[model samples]
Structure formats: structure tokens, C-alpha cells
Target: MCGKRWILDNKTLLREYIKKYRYFSLNNVVQSIGIKRCVAIKYLQLFKSEKIVFSAGRGFYTSEGREFIYPKISRVIKIRQLIIKEFPNLDFIIWNTLYFQPYYHHQQTHNITVVEVEYDGIQSVVEIISRFYRNVITESKRKLCTSEFDITNDPIIVRPFIRRSPRDGNEPRLEKMLVDIYIINYKYKIMADVDFWELWRSLFSLYRIDFSKLIDYAVGRRNMRVLISQLIDNAGLKEVIFDSKYDLLSNMTRKKGGRCRDGKTRHKTVGIIEKRNTI
Candidate 1:
């Protein structure tokens, strides 16, 4: 076969082979197609560019090629601009809850901008932001429940940054946002268990979330075990990251019945995570 015709024919065959497995490794493709490892990797890259396949971590490729859509950051950038103009050297991260509206079942009615600045600059950052924004809170989530303060009114929360929080440029990434929201809800009861699980389910089904990155952020926040238990029991994400180092947690979960002592029943939303079909 000529080189061009051979490439075209092999590409068609590869697509057909890929359709048989929801998730497959490079070895699976090489052995099944009787191709070299280098050739299989080349083909996988072509498939990725064509939106026919996507990396699912741990050397696995998934045929479901749903791309992660970045939230609109125009408003976030405006806030960042205001902060940067004041303290050009300040190291900080800024994000808003309004970015998560599409991932929730019931639309979130309120918008809260969170500004996490370095320890040395947090007080000054808060002072600068307070001059422009009326509904600004500094370092106290306890005040969120006060009758005097209305959370529904868009609030700007200025807090000190923790070392090693995940970021995309000057804004928090999806991984960081997931961990923070989960921990906040765990501590404050801002949303019911059922509602929280539903939001996670919707997000997992629609977006390409980095499970490992999310876990790392949760670990930094000292909520790794709590978050992983919720992921396996409540969100039914065990199978999604089964190949990860968290595989041992699956056994622990079964032995413990994966129940939290809070007395509120956690409903497991399953089948949203893509299954691994035999190659």
C-alpha cells in the first residue's frame, strides 16, 4: 500500500477498534491493531485532535471526548484588574460563584467573588476592594449567617491565600473550586446533602474534571478523606478513577458502608460516570 492510502485505511480501522472499548490503553490498541507503539501513540494524538478520543489519565483513553468548557471570566478579569491596579506586585487568586451556574441543577441566584491574596497583602487588598464594593466581607464566613448581612447581594470575600492552591492564571481552577465548595458545605450546611450530590453529578456528566487534581486540592485543604468518601458514595465516581491510587478507598468504603454520621441520608447518583468496556 502507498503511504497516504495506508494511513487513511489504518485511521478508519482504528476508529472502528476504538468504538469497541469505552476506555483503552496504548497496549490494547497496539496488540489489537497489530501496530507499533509509536504508531498507536501517533494515531491517538490524531484522534484527540479530531475529538474522537480524550485522555482519561493513568494511561487510559476514553472515546467520549467531551471538552471542558472554561467559564466566562470577563467579570472576574474586571475584578482582577481593579486589584492589580492597586497592588501591582500582589500575588492573589480571584473567582466568582456565578461561574458555576451551568453546573448546578437549580440555578444559583447569588454571586460571590472570592479574593485570596498572599498573607502579607491580604489586609491591604481588602482595604482597596472595600473602597469600591459596598458588600465586602473579610476573613469571616461566620458573618454570612448574620441577619444584618445579606449574602444574596453580591458579596466580595477577601481572604488570605493558602499555599499550593490550584490556579489558572490569576483565577482558581475547577479543581480548587470543587474542593473549596465541598468543604464549605460540609462545615456550614449551606446546601443539603442531596442538592450537593446532584450538583456534583451534573458537573461530572457535563465536564472533563481532573479527578486527581481535585483530590490534590482537597488534600491541601485537609479534607481528602471526606471529599473522597463523598465522591465514591454520593457522586458514584469510584469507577471513574478506579485506576488511581484511591483504589484502596473502594474497599474501605464497602467495609464502612460509606455512611457519614450526620444522620442525613446520602443518595448515590450512579451511571453518570462512563464505564470501562472490555477491549
Candidate 2:
């Protein structure tokens, strides 16, 4: 996952994410926060109307292409290998909308952004990773992430650039995703910095992986979805990162159950997680 900070759906904040993470799909963004589907779609449309996000697919897509669709980090690394075929001295960063001017402008955005996160050990990682594991809950982010309908009636997005000086210390939020994503009446745009594609190809040239056997690559896991992906793609690997949310969830359930081997409910592990999932 690209370490993106969330600026709730205020007029200024929504537009910034659109510009900074151009490749972000409304689905990816909202789904990360666990919003309901119809509600997600409803808001995406509104964003389109307000010109906050541009739709690439029907009722879907602020960021276009399969690259943004899946969050497989390994495959992403492989693709990075392919991209580095030419440019060598390349480094990438993840810049979210708030870093820019609060409008999802194509200009002042970044390709891959990372926020230094706290590692509270395995349990926390598992819980955060499990969002990808959800089954059958109407995935609001999946549908809403894109801009499907016409946004011609939407207002033009605007902003004034304010560069943050080194002295302006801002504390980073720890992936401030609420258990439930707040629905926006306006569509939120997912965008990638336009320059990232070029940077990707350049980065691909530096990888040690041999491209001869490379057909494509898949992200090895989901939680590292965005960050790992850019690195992988830059490696010149034929990459296609994917998520196995349900797959992981199933394994987690089986492994934990086998250890306890319990038929009865215990508030400690499985029961608690299942209850959390239900909410």
C-alpha cells in the first residue's frame, strides 16, 4: 500500500488526492476504508459532477488501467524490472493529494508514495491485511473508485500551490482509515503522477532479474499492494499483481482453528475477528 494520508471529503482535500495519486481507483481508496458498495458509487458520481474525479470506466475509475486494479506487490516489482530497461538512476516516491494543491491535478503528483508506518508486530499487520480478505460485503471502494458517468456538469477543480518548508513539521497519520469509510456525496478521484510511467521504465533498467523468462509478475501479497507494485514494475518484469484476500482469510481461519481445535466460541480469537468482520 502506498502510504497515503486521508484528507476527508472536504472540498480541498478530495481534489488533492485526485491529483496526487492519479492512478488510485475510487474502489481501491474506499474499499481500503470498508465502505458499502451502493453508497460508494453514489458518492463517486457526486465527485464526478463536482469535477473532483474523472471517470475512466462506467461508474468506475479515477485512475485508469489494470495496474491500479490489483494490489499484488511481487508482480509490481517484476513490472518495475521491465520499466528499468533504459533509465537507471531513478528513485520513486509516493505523494498523496494533500501533498499537492488539494486538486487531483496531473502535474505536481507522484508515482509511488510511502509513509513510514508503525509495526506493532504480526497481529496488527494481520488485522490491517484482512480487509482484503473480506467476502461478499458490498465493496464500496471497488465500484466507487472509478468515474463512470459524465462529469461535464461538474465544476472545475482548483487550488493554489503551497510548498511545505522543512521547518513546517507535520505529524504523519498512521494510515488513518476508520473501520468504516465515510461516504462522500462527491466522487473522489484516483490519479497517478503523469511522470511515473516514464520513471517506471527508467527504474526497470536497474534490476537484477532476467527478463527472458518473464511473461508477467503478480504481487506476492496485498498489504504491500501499491508500494511493492511500483518497485516490481520498475524491475522490468512482466508484472500483474493480484490480491487473494479470501484465500488468506481462509488460511488464517483454518490455521488458528487447528491450533485451538475448538468447536466452541472463544472471545479471544476467531470469534472476535468474525464479529469485527460482520461490523
All candidates' TM-scores?
0.67, 0.21
| Best candidate (score: lDDT) | 1
Evaluated with TM-score, which candidate comes out highest?
A: 1
lDDT of 1 by residue, 208-239 (tens): 66554565456556566657766778886654
Clashes per model (N, Cα, C within 3 A) = 0, 71
**What is candidate 2's lDDT per residue for 1-279, written digit by digit as tens?**
232322244334445545555333445545554655664666567776766655432223342222111133442244234324322332221112233222222443322222111222223322432333321111121243224322222211111111221111222111111000111111332333333343334323322221111111111111222333333454232321124333222222322333335665333433434443311
Report lDDT (CA) for all predictions. Answer: 0.67, 0.30
